[model samples]
Target: MALRTYDEYIESLKAMRPNIYKFDELIEDVTTHPATRNTVVGHGHSFKLSSEPEYKDIFTTTSHLTDEPISRYLSVIQNREDMWANSRLKRRMFQLSGTCTGGRCVGWTSLNSMYATTYDIDQELGTDYHQRLRAWLKDAQRRDITIAGALTDPKGDRTKTPSQQDDPDMNLRIIERRKDGIVVRGAKVMICGVAAANEIFILPGSAYREADKDYALSFVIPRDIENLTIVETRHPSDKREHEEGFDIPVSEGGITQAYLFFEDVFIPNERVFMAGEYKFTKQAVFNFISAYRAAIGGCVAGQGDIKIGAAMLVARANGLHTKVFKDKIIQMQINNETTFGIGIAAAALGKEHPSGTWLCDMTLANVNKVHVATLPYETSRLAQDIAGGIGETGCMPSWKDFQSSRYGHLIEKYLKASSSAESRTRAARLVEWLTIGAGVPGCMHGGGSPDGAKLMIRAFGDLESKVEIARRLAGISEEIPEPGGR
Candidate 1:
C-alpha cells in the first residue's frame, strides 16, 4: 500500500462496507456520519502530517519489510530511537487531535507486539506465524490502511476463566477450524475506533490454560467481514457529537469505543498469527502492554499540555494574568513530565529481543502506566480549578442558543467577560471538553487498569534485594519479622 494523502485516507474509508452502528442506526458513510466522522478525521490527520516537512521524520519510517517509507503507525519498533519516536508521535497526535486516535495507536502497538511474539513462537514450535506476520505487515505497509486493535472481551464473570465461564462466548474464541481458515465467535467489548479502521488486529484477552485453548487466538480481519457486527458505545458526550461549533472542542476529531460481535467470522490462515497457542498468550499480552503503557505516557502528556493551555486561555478570558495560577500550572507540568519521563526511562532501559524487536522495561513501563492512570486526572482538576465556574460547570448556553435570532444579542451581551463573548464561550467550552467531555482519552483505564499495572509492578519488583541492602547499611544480620511474622 502506498502512503495515502488526507483525501485518499478519507476516500479509503468511504470505500469500506458499512458495518458500524450507533443506537440501532446503520452508518452508511463513516466519512460524514457524526458518530464516526470525528474519529475518521482525527486519524486522517496522521496521514496529512506524514507528508509535512516538519513532522515527516516522526510520522514516517522505513518499513523493514519493503525498504519503502511507511506511516510510523504501520512500521515496527526495532530500537530505542524507534520507541522514542513512537512516544513522540502519540504525544503530537493528542496535541493536535485533542483525543484518542485508537483507530491507529492501539493497532500499531498490536502489530509491533506480534512482531516479537510471532518470532518467538515460530522459533520454538517451528510454526509459520512469524513468516505470515511479516508477509501481512508488508502488504499492510503497502496498503497503508488504518488498523484498530481489540483485546477486551465481553467477559461475563470477572472471577471465572474463559473456559469456566457459564457462557463460552464470554471471550472471543475459535469456533471452527476450517481447512482454509478459522471461524470465530463472541465479542470484544469497549474497543476503540472500529468505525475509522479498515482492519482490526485481535489478540487473546488474557493468558489462557490448555483448557482455554480456544480462547488463545490472535488474528487480523477486515472490519466489515461477513458475520461481524459493530455497535458504537455511548459516552458522556453523546448528545453533542453532532452539535456544530465550539460546543464540541476539536469538532473534526473525537473519541469512540465500540462493541464487536463476531458470528462465525472467518479469518484466513495467512492473517492468523496465533491459533490455540495457549502457551504463548502471556508473553504476547505482556509484550503488547509494555509498549502500549509506555507510549500512553505521551498520550496523556500531550493532552495534559492542552489542559495547561486551556487553563491559561480561560484565565485570559476572565481578564486575569496566567501568572496568578503559576503554582497550579507548574504542578500540571510536573505531572506531565513525570509520566513522560518514566516512559522514556522504560524505553531507554529496554533490551532487544532475539527477534530484533525492542521491548520496554516492564517495571518502569508499568510504573508509568500507574502514573498515567492517576496524574492526568489531577492535572485536569488543576485545569478546572483555575478555569472558574463557567469552564468547569458546563453551564454555558448552547452554541445554537447563543446564535438564535430572537435573543442572540442579549445572550452575547451578558455572556461577555473581559474578552468578547464569543471568545470566552469558545475558551470555556474547550476547557469543559478537555476536563470532562469527549476530549478526555482513556487515561485511567485505557490500555489496562491502574490496579492491573500495580500487579505487574509487584511481579517485577526486587524487594528482597532492597531488604538485603538495607540490612547491610544498618549492620543488622538478624532477620526482621513483619506484623504477620511470616
Candidate 2:
C-alpha cells in the first residue's frame, strides 16, 4: 500500500518480512522492537510533516516523470527552486525527528547520484542506465516506498581495497552473473534503517580499479530478499532502555546502524543501476555529495535548534540561566542559523547540470558540510556546559514513591521544578538524551568525518588562482616578462 500517513508507514514496517538479526537472534517484530522503534518513529515524523499544509510545498513535489505527487525525497530537483525547497524540507524533517531521521538523507542522496551519474554513464558508454534508473524511480514513487541506501562498505583493513580484503565478504561485491540477473555477496556496514526500509539501494563506497571490477556493484533489492540478512548494531543505551523502560535517562534517540549481508542474493537486471562502472563511481559519489552535503547544513542546524532550546530549559530549571548562559544561547542560535544559511546559499546558487536537473553550487555545498561537521559539536559542548553536575546526577525517582499515599505528598513536594524535582529531572534527561545519549557523536560523523570536510575544502578551494593573485600583486606577471624570462 502507498504510504500517505505516518500511521501507514508504521503499519507497513509491521507487516515487512525480513531476516533481521539484532544481537545473535532473529528479530520477529522490528516495528515494535525497542531497538528499531525509535528510529521508525523518527522516520514516521518525516513522512507526517510532508502532509502538513504549511510544509507541503517544501516536502511534497510533482514527480518529473509521472507528474504525480510524491515525497520530496523521491523527486529529482528539476529547477533551482526545487533545490532550495528540498533543503528547507530536510531541515524541518530532521528537527521534527530530533537529530537523526534514520538515513533518509542517504536514500535521497542515492537518488540524486543515480540520476546524474546514470545520465553521464549513458552519454559516455551508450548504456541505458539513465533510462532504467528513471523507470525504477518512477515505480518507487508510484509505490511510495522507503529506501535505505547502503554506501559504506566494511573496509576490513584501511590499507586494502575491497578485492584485497582478508575476507572478500568484508566488502560487498558482485559474485556471479546469470542471463537474467546477477548474484552478490559481502556486506554493507553502518546501514541506517535497513530493517525499516522497504528497499536497500546498494552502491560501492569508493571508486574501483579494473582488478576490483567485481567490487563495483550497484543495485536495488527488497529488504526481505531471502538471502539478505541485517544484523543491527546495538546502541549504547539500548540495554538500559529495555531493562528500565522510560526511566532510563534518555529514552528516545537514533537506534542503531545495521550491517547488511548479501549472501548470493540475486538482483534482476532491471534493478541494476550500475555494475562494474568503475569511472562512474567517482561521478556518483560527487553527484551525491553535491546535493547531500548542502542538505546536512539544514538538518543539523534544525537539530541545533532543539538542542539549544533544551539547554536553555535545563539551565532555567537548574537556576543557571545567567547572562553567560544567555550569551551561549545566542552563540547556539548563530551557529544554527549560519549552518542553515549555507544550505540556502548552496541551493540559491544552484546550477542545472547537463543532465537536465539542477546541481547545487559545489563550493557552497562543501562549505555547508564543513560547517555541519563542526557547529553541532560546539552546540553540544555548550549544552553540556549549561546542564552542569545535576544533569549527570539526576534520575527518575521510582513511580512507587509517587504512588504511595504517605510518600506521594512528599514525593510531589520534592519533585517540583523550581522547588520541583520533576522539572529538574526532565531538564537533565533532555540534556543527557541529546548530548551523550544518541545525537552528538552521530551528527559529527553521520554525513562524513571532519577530515572529509577538510578534504572537500582543499579540493574546492582554488589555491592556484590565489597563487596567481599573489604573483600579480608582487608585479611578477608573465605579461610583464618577470625576472627577464620570456
Question: How many residue pairs clash in each candidate at the backbone level?
Answer: 2, 6
Q: Candidate 1: which stretches are off by over 4 Å?
A: 247-249, 478-486
Candidate 1: Cα lDDT at 441: 64
Residue pairs in candidate 1 whose N, alpha carbon or C atoms collide under 3 angstroms: 1-142, 1-143
The per-model lDDT (C-alpha) reads 0.89, 0.75
- Candidate 2 structure quality by residue, lDDT tens digits, 151-267: 748778978987788788777788898888788888777877676677888777877888788877778788888898889887756644243423443333364688887789999
Model 2 scores a TM of 0.91
Best by TM-score: 1
Reference-based TM-score of each model: 0.97, 0.91
Across 195-305, the per-residue lDDT of candidate 1 in tens digits comes to: 889899998888889999999989999888989999998876776534476744476578889999998899999999999989999998999999999989999999999
Indicate which candidate wins on lDDT: 1
